[model samples]
Target chain A: MTAVAAPTRRRRQRRHISPVVWLFLLVPAAIEVGLVFWPALNSFYLSLTRWNGLGAPEQVGLDNFRELFSDGVFREALGNNVIWAVGFGGLSVAGGLALAVALNKPRRGVGVYRSAIYLPMVFSLAVTGLFWRVQYQPDGTVNTLLGAVGLESLERQWLADPKTALYAVLVAAVWRQVGYVMVLYLAGLKGTDPSLDDASAVDGASAWQRFWYVTWPQLRGVNTVVFAVTVIDSLRTFDIVWAMTQGGPYHSSELLSTYMFQQGFTFLNLGYASAVAVVIFALALLFIITYLVRTLKEEVS
Target chain B: MSAPAVTAPAPPAASPSTSHDRQRVRRRGWAFHAVMVPLTLLWVAPMAFVVLISIRGFDDIAARGTAALPDSFTFEGFRTAFGEGAMGEALWTSVQVTVPAVILSLLLASMAAFALSRYAIPGRRAILLVMLAGNLLPPQILLIPVSRITESLGIYDTLVGLVAIHVGFGLGFYTFVLHGFMRSIPSEVTEAARMDGAGAFAVYARIVMPLCRPSLAALGALATTWIFNDLIWAITVLRTQAKFPVTAALLNLQGGYVSNWNVVAAASIMAAIPTAIVFFAFQRHFVSGLLMGSAK
Candidate 1:
């Protein structure tokens, strides 16, 4: 019996310690390191130097960082990113939460409504940009509708104007994002125990009170996810802006992501671009670190 | 089984109260519909407009501005878009890149996810965090180095290069998602396979993989739409118009057809079709997958 049991235990140990696990991890790990991690690290090194695509990089030390603070466009880009983070993020989350609450009830045709709302999210930002670009034309659908409603004075060249360009893009972005946040919150609502809602109702809680005290707490997980996604998405907003206005009309809508792309690819200022990229990276990493800490703590607990 | 009983009206003595409650519920439901139906229509109106504009005659659009109702409908824009516009070629290029990228990323991600979640690997938490961070990092940060690397490796300006970059970048999110999914699977199933003398590969390929069909489908659909819709990587890596994916190609079409709303609208709608189809087809899995990643 001892011999049989010992052999069995040894076999189990061998199975658990199989080399295939290492093999499985090897290629993906290599790709991740080579493509993403290495490149990200290289950006830090590149930020300290001045290089065009064709020339050897010259080490400029802190000059790029110094210039970044003083550069007017960079300042504007940074400011726009902040506005984007706050405006787009706030609107999407709030709108999504509201929609989710309204749609959370078991009503007929709710699925159809949800799908229709989510349809825009299925299209690429490119499609969204073009669609809105068409709508925002001086005599386009938005203005036409406004005219029909006797609000012709309110209509303007939405994407062409500096003051409204970023907001215009933000509107299109919010259109797509609201659906994503709604779906997440909807999922969170589904997981919530209905008994708690019923219990609150029985205790004479009003609808708003029940939501504020009970449903809101239950949705905390989804709120964090929505907040993180919104922040990251706001930071990485490029495609729609690029497609719509190309950061044009004198760079009114320039975002950090778009600015970095222009610097690196268009102007070929690799080092300066790297500095911009590094700043963007730093901003994203801050939130990423916080999120990881929270998630990891949860995991360990 | 008891649903109908609870929903059914009460006895005659309580009929008046029950009827009043029924009326109020019905009114509330009607109000909900009143608000939701039009809001949903408004939400879908932009895409509906794209469809409406796609088939309109160019002459009609030019004669009367984009807001004008079409006097007649034709597939002239599609013909132009697919023919001289070369949208068909761009779409083909997109397919060439998206299909392999989705398949390869899913394959690699599932393998990594299986090991990280199933095995007692060292530094598992660190690995997970790194992948998640990589996914969250803006692609602009890696643009220069990755472009240079691709050029050095002789894959730059090639579809293969774009495919590699997409697979690499996509791996982070896919791995994160799959890791969540795989962890939720019962360990006993794989252990049972092990007891039957199945090797690690067999346990993964036969046992674990088969059980993960729902998640695989979900990720596949989501990734396909994402990679297909990708504009940045394609624009950065691919140079020639011949190699341009639909998204990048649409940009080119926009440049040429800036004045021609009909052709541009048609091309944009054409580019949107595949993703729209994929989203609707896998709607259930797609939503569940998103929730799985976030709600954990």
Candidate 2:
């Protein structure tokens, strides 16, 4: 800890800007600003215009925003995004926390179980999307298994039904996300001060009471991070939804990201898509700003 | 990946335990296994299905359906999938883009990370914030203008365009992780080198770079998986099927062979192999990197 403290003191006193610093920083800064920040800012400006990929830009201030509000598809997309954020984010985090708590202690074959649970996290969402899409077919594995288990009456067209399409996609998203959350929580659990657990155990506290009072409080940092990640991931979702449904069945599963893609590339409504992109950006920015402020404060302290 | 050693050593500081405590611990372990074993099986079942479908003949699948056990298994699907020639080209394209993107991004990010972590730069916190914010923004927001930029720069629909966007997009998260790792290094080592008249470049090259190998390796493994798995950028930037990465190509293959579930399954499984291999090989570092970045 003192090693880090000494560097801060030295950093404050050292005022000279080396030429090496410029050389090292220039290329990454150029790429980041040019490709990322510049384009992100340009998305805002593009939203206010009525330009396709070709032809001169025609300025149409706030028209796209107005159109977006009135657009039923966009509204559906927004509603689905909210549902996705809540459903996928909430379920995955809860599932992950549960898995983490279960696997926290050292036990035989725990590593194998951890690996099996995390295996889905490594696959591309494209593959997972396709895999689940097939499995959700009416005559697919899901229905077949249900029939074999004597639940034939409960089977439905999982992906084809508008009411269940977004939820079906959410199931796949959660499959991948839960593993990520579990890994993070497991690491957090390992780093926790076990003496606190032992002290509470000695105090005649029940197991659940010890965990809720002593353990969960220590995991506030992991919870914030997991929540932020879940929010951002839900907003950034595209590959799986696009690959599976293409936001179809009357745009029932249309997320903001997928909607942005449809408007810009598929429909050539670049301006309208940019507006959708802006909304996505705004939603992500809200959580990102909070996360950054908190993490940076931690860095400082 | 190396399996975590599973020695069940009791905590040294644990007080003398009664028989009741021993029974409780045993019960907890049993409960954990009872819950986790089935969940783990359920989680892996999807991919296992894909692998099974990929190996069976299309006729076998058509006759038996996807859920039933195959009457016979053959590599005919794999042969047809790979012999189509597009898979090979797409895999090459993926390699072409992912390799350069990972290398260039890591090079640039490590340099930036060293400067931010070691020096007394102006507005360092602001710069860090900017990088974090850039990473956190959804890529769809950049899709419109970035594609236009690539077009104007004459790199659109090319591997160069793909690599450039990947590097640019990857810079933030890589730098964030590398900076955190670099900051934890003891500064006295660098101070001594500086006192010995080593220039900043010399200090960075001879000192910081070597120290960053573990983090760099971790980021490299992760970045490769991400760039290879990317579909949105490939769909937005590349115009030709010939230049499509494996993920996009898999989507195309699925479209072209919609009725041929066996071929699509084979192609999808093939597309997934590289990342799976990378993940298993570097599982330890990858998990550590993720935990390091998120857990702070």
Candidate 3:
């Protein structure tokens, strides 16, 4: 049934005797598996003890969890991470959606405007946070601006007040993250069939009506992805908080990441930190799975 | 800011029978521009402060606050940051580790992606899933074994060790992503190249590499951002204080300091500049390719 193949004809298909390929593929994959498995497993082992990471670790199972529940600092850090998730993940998406819509309409200088908005997304979180630390100083620009605008009564210590500190970080966080969300939405918007908008417009639909009814539905999948990623990034954030306040004013701005670092390295409490790492891994995994499932469904459909 | 008049989004492109309708579209376009410009400034306002703060003398930073312009502009903060035993060396340390990590991974990932995308290997899909999972797992979970693994190999405090870790973690996501991009390059082109007796490497280097420029640039920028700003692994694996990356140098600006805000601010802008430069340089390819891949 198949084309009759001569013996020499089959043999003449050049041999793919490439040994280097095996080395290239297997070597990196092996390194990753080894690195990922070892510490992840070690963290679980360490979590069963009371190791300060320096000396002998006492084998005291469940005590760390027990103490963690009672620990005021851990509770505060958890609260702060939740706040960060809402602020960075929730607020930034909303702001990014607003800005993306506003800028999506083509106009003069729109490219410059788009580029400027996305500028903060490229900045290291530490740099952005460091700059904001100066901005939040009692005698800082924020205060000066308030004074200049005759709102001097509202000016106060931004980072020092526990009530206001985490919010201040979120303000800067939103400034950095909104652009990222805008870019994602912009990409989705580009993919959108513009004819649908024109068709709806010809039917006497207002621009707002077309966006709400037509454009928003097309953007559903992208929105799901943005929400999930923003949440993960928010939870894993360490650099910014560490840079500006170091979880200061009595651990007020502390998130799980910064708290884990302080406990593991600074205080040499490795076992506890590993447990916290486990928590972070679980959370990130949950978000990623949701994103993958939704995106995969869209691909299949 | 001048866009060379690309003829991108013009109101005149819209069909208009009446001049009033065209006029209405133009007004909307101008209104949209009005809103976005102010929003963009609010977005970048904080970064503006950091650059300004980096140039001020220590006395001015203290006296006038971060918002106020320097009374006498000077490069004193820059001098302090690059002084002996400061972030200047750390910045170099970051580059030394980052460049090799990025280049080597790009090579390995291209090879792997080529094979996985083009072949009918039974385990290819499963292997890709496993690799993607490895990337999804947080880096904090890998720090302990990475540290001990480097120590056992006797390269824990060296730049080589850091490079190795970056390459290791980078492979999973890099390979997974590059495979998708390689898949997008139509198979007809590679088949034609094969007819010309081009070997695997030639096909990759000549045909595939040129075509996959967007993906490669995106991957390079992604890897650079990751390795440069990474604080956790840098501090964990590099025990010696001086071997610390600039990201870790930010930590040194910590401790119960006797009020060192100016130096901290200066060091921060220095550490952030390389990435910002890269962003500006590859802004188009970096944003479009990456956002397309992820959002798609």
DockQ scores of the candidates = 0.57, 0.61, 0.48
Q: What tens-digit string does per-residue lDDT give for candidate 3 at A111-228? A: 8888888877777777777778878888778998899999999998999998888889888888888888989998889889999999998999987999999999999888888988
Error of 3 at B266 (Å): 3.2
Chain A of candidate 1: what's the TM-score? 0.93
As a whole number from 0 to 100, the lDDT of residue B22 in candidate 3 is: 58
| Candidate 3 lDDT score at position B7 | 35
Tens digits of per-residue lDDT for model 1, A1-301: 3666656654565467678888888889899889999998999999999999777899999999999999999999999999999999999889888888988775667677788777788889998899888778786788888999999888899888898999999999899888988998988899898999999998999999999998999877677777877887888899999999888778899999999999998899999999999999889877777667766766667
TM (chain A) per model: 0.93, 0.94, 0.90
| Model 2 docking category | medium
Where is model 3 chain B poorest over a 10-residue stretch in terms of lDDT? B1-10
lDDT of 2 at A40: 90
Which segments of candidate 2 are over 4 A away from where they belong? Answer: A1-15, B1-24
Classified by CAPRI criteria, candidate 1 counts as: medium
> lDDT of all predictions, in order shown?
0.86, 0.87, 0.77
Candidate 1 stretches greater than 4 Å from native: A1-16, B1-14
Name the DockQ score for candidate 2.
Answer: 0.61
